[model samples]
Target: MNKIELLELLHQEVVPALGCTEPVAVALSTATAAELVGGAIEKIEIIVNPSIYKNGMAVGIPGFKHVGLNYAAALGALLSNPKDKLQLFNKITDEISKKTIELIEKKLVIVTIDRSKEVLYIEAIIKTTEGTARCIIKNSHDNIFLIEKNGVLLSEQKELTILDNQLYKRLSDLKIEEIVRIIDSCTEEELLFMYDGVLMNTALADFGLSEQNKDGLGIAHSLKKLTKNDVLGDTLFSRIMVKVASASESRMSGCPYSAMSSAGSGNHGLTTIIPVVEFAKYMESEKIKLLRALAIAHTLNVYIKQFSGKLSATCGCGVAAATSASSAMVYLMNGSTNQMGKTIINMIANLTGMICDGGKIGCALKLATASNAAVMSAYLAYSDIVIPSSNGICASTPEDTVKNLGRVSKLGMQTTDKVILDIMLEKVMNNN
Candidate 1:
């Protein structure tokens, strides 16, 4: 891909999001449907595939303390402008929160799981005095595919397919060398947007470490305390882990800050961007060099997700996003492109089997682990230490190794995904 094409890809994938993408996508669909009907909402019904259902089960929504798909649907139906897209909760207020709670108590919103649909599917049907409206999102978050009003089809556009058919295909076909070349060819002016991500996520990390965010998981806070007392050294690895985990905690706990999401996930963005930013700061690298490293990180992130699907059983933060971050770290250290490839291989060998049960406060732990591993992988690759291709499921080349990891995620993990969901659902049922 050329410079312009590379910029287009970054613009499409690296954007701001509030809260976890799965539940936010649920709200987006409901908001669209509610706007289409244009009256008092009598009831709302949300249907999602198993992957969406599993992911939204325990995650917190932005601007509210409540958690689950029911609250998200009600909040969208009552007070959301569809045009805001993923940042729909930017204007949520205390009164709105109370009203959304009343709507939930009234039980006007119902959510169900459909096992037969695609992995990323959400359908919202809203009933109003005026009419009933339906909206559907598939393939990726924010890609609305169909809309209908009063039994008549109003509009239909498959935006995801259009991008996937052309740009995504080109992206998936490029080798590691070509990806590095594309990042090198871009001017610094075209890549400054990545620094915006650093600022946004740093805000989240600050929130997570603040005393007012008492409800957060406290992993980062505890790490900082340990470093202060000499229980843990204040090294680069610990700092990177704490910073990235803090941002993940804040996002998962509904901090209301917009995260610069990568490949449709806020946690992925935290894992991919913060580690590289911290490394550059420690190394005292030039601004242009930092931008180029970020370009490599974000590009490789999108390329890996092209194989892993938008949502999957595997933890994208650990396996896909961190792998990209490791490669970027190698680049920042003035390591060759060959060493960068080895860094990718090391990351895959380390974190390929980490499962993604759902999005919740506990995700902070996984983000911390992934961040530390990423730094270690980069260091090892810089020292010329790498996992041999003869090992299990590893290929001779980085591109082929990524393809192997994709196979494990897409084909080998189907049964594992179902069982994990079953266990989660069983717990919910027992609680009731």
Candidate 2:
């Protein structure tokens, strides 16, 4: 892709989402299928590819006291908006919870396997009072294809899967310098457009603070206390940390506010943007400079995630957000391109391979630590400190180190992912 096309691609891949992308995808598929059926769905069947199951196992759905494909399916069928896309399950409300519980009690949801396909597909079948319909999302979450109703096919053609597979190859081929050039030189018009991301993500953080949901980690409260302190030195850090961390805490706990998501996940967007925003505001930086830095942070995350794939055994947020923060910190310090490059290397060496269990309050804790690491790595790079090529997973250059980290995440961590998934499944299956 050319620079303009690549920027647009990154924009589309990293969009808005509510709750965990996995379960929202389930709800989206279910909602689309139910729309085809055209009535109250009597029975809902979900068939997921192995990768989907792995990503969905531990995520939360706001208002639902459970985390799994079944509840997601139920919530989707009960309250989802087909046109809303990323906010697929945003319609879920307290009024619908009672009806959803009744449906669960009736054994109306059946989650099964898609035996005749690859390890990355989801087929949701809705049998309603009128007839049966189906919807399938392939490649990445919310990439819906082939919606069918009764004996009539409502939609056909799966357009992106074949093309999306090529994305991993293309990303692996990109040079880190090229990615940096794209971010560093994007025009003001293009950079300012991402204010949409800031607006939506900030709104969600505010909502999480207001709701004070017990399950949430109270990042907002922490910020409030810090702001209330009579001291000015700590107030800025407190506000930014609280804003960024609280958003993660709320989203992980299934907050209803839509997240300006990246790489099919909202937490990814929050993780990447909040730290940069917090730091920029702390320095009383110019508004335009802050926007440019935010753009750099968000787009760099998308760039890295392109190589990492949408879902991985390793935590994309850890490296993605950290790299973004590194670049933004460099920009804020008026550091040179070399400084930014070194910051990226420092970040990759320090925070690579954090595991993603699922979206929850604990994720906030991880994000906080990652944000701290990002600040440290960027400061170190600005001060001319970077890991050498001889270090473990380090290479002769920054780009080489990143590629090495990608290998570890996509190839080296396969067994670790399986072990984590197996343990999670065991806990869920054995709970009753």
Candidate 3:
């Protein structure tokens, strides 16, 4: 991939998010529509795909106790800031929260299934004294394609172009060796920009650990108390898993801090980077080495997700995110592209079927387990002990293998995703 393409991809996918991307995207669209109306919003109507509704219905919006898309939509209108992107709640006030709750209680804020075929879609329409304003995001979490005010179009809706699809394939088409070579020769400007992932993600991990006992369920504290080395063996491994887990724990449980999410997921970003960053620090690796490793990790993550689609029945954290980290681990250990491929194969072979239940605190456990498994998978690959392609769901090459894994997630697991959503919604309706 060209440097320009890679940098643009990073700019598009890797950005800060305050909470789960689904709910956060809803908040962004809602806030944008509210601002477009240019007056007090009387009603907020949010229409989303089933997948978006499923994912956003339970995850917490940052800075609020409420854990649903309704709160996010209302707060978006109350705050009136769309430029914040996923960090839409950073400007929320107590008065806004009360007003948002009032709007929700009065049924002025509404959420419904879009009925359209979009998997990642959010349409927010806000009604004010002046008129109604609308914003629509589709295909990507933050790609707002349509905007309107007072029943008039505000922007031309361009069709998704061939160049866009090429952008998606640019990373997917890169060989592991080619990726490593590019990272090895990357410019200082790129390296410095990439280092921000480490700093941004590490900040969340650090804050999570610091506030473990105070607000959250103390995922970091629990991991620390687990008599290190008993669960995963040794201090180094514990450090990596604990840091990744704690950051996830903090984010999942609503820590009110934004994370530098990769592939449009904050948890995925934390899962992919925290372990590698912690490992580089633990080993005191050179700055250049660490930056390259991070680049490779992100590249692999984005490539794998290309096939898996954005949200799937299979957990991207376990499959794509962990696979990326495992491969990066091989790189950090001075292993070859072949060894990194083996690591990817080994990790995907084991983690392919893990379910994505939702975005909640329990996700911390899943991410930590994946992080721990990535280390083990990398070690085994580095030692040339790999699962053969003949094994179940394992292919001869890394690219083919990732595509196969993608098939399992995208095509094979259709029923699984549907049932999971049904059960989740059923429980909610039954409770009501």
1 or 3, which is superior by lDDT? 1
Candidate 1 structure quality by residue, lDDT tens digits, 289-376: 9999988998999889887767789999999999999999999999989899999999999999999999988999999999999999
Q: Number of clashing pairs, model 3?
A: 0
Residue 111's lDDT in candidate 1 = 92
- Give a tens-digit lDDT track for model 2, residues 71-125: 8888887774688776766567787777778878899998875534443578898
lDDT of each: 0.88, 0.74, 0.84
Q: 1-432, model 3: which lDDT tens digit per residue?
A: 877777677777777888889888898898888888887778888888878887787776777888888888988888889898888778888899899889888999888876455468788989998799999988788888899999999984677722267887677788878877877777766767777778888998888888443656777778877745476455767888888888888887778778888888999899888889877877688888888888888878888988887888888999999889999988999998999999999998999879987787888888989998999999999998889999999998888899899889989998898888888889888987
Q: What is the TM-score of each candidate against the true structure?
A: 0.97, 0.88, 0.96
Worst 10 residues of 2 by lDDT: 231-240
Model 2 off-target regions past 4 Å?
Answer: 63-66, 93-95, 113-120, 151-172, 207-213, 218-240
All candidates in order of TM-score, best leading: 1, 3, 2
Pairs that collide, model 3: none
Sort by lDDT, best first: what order?
Answer: 1, 3, 2
Steric collisions counted per model? 0, 0, 0
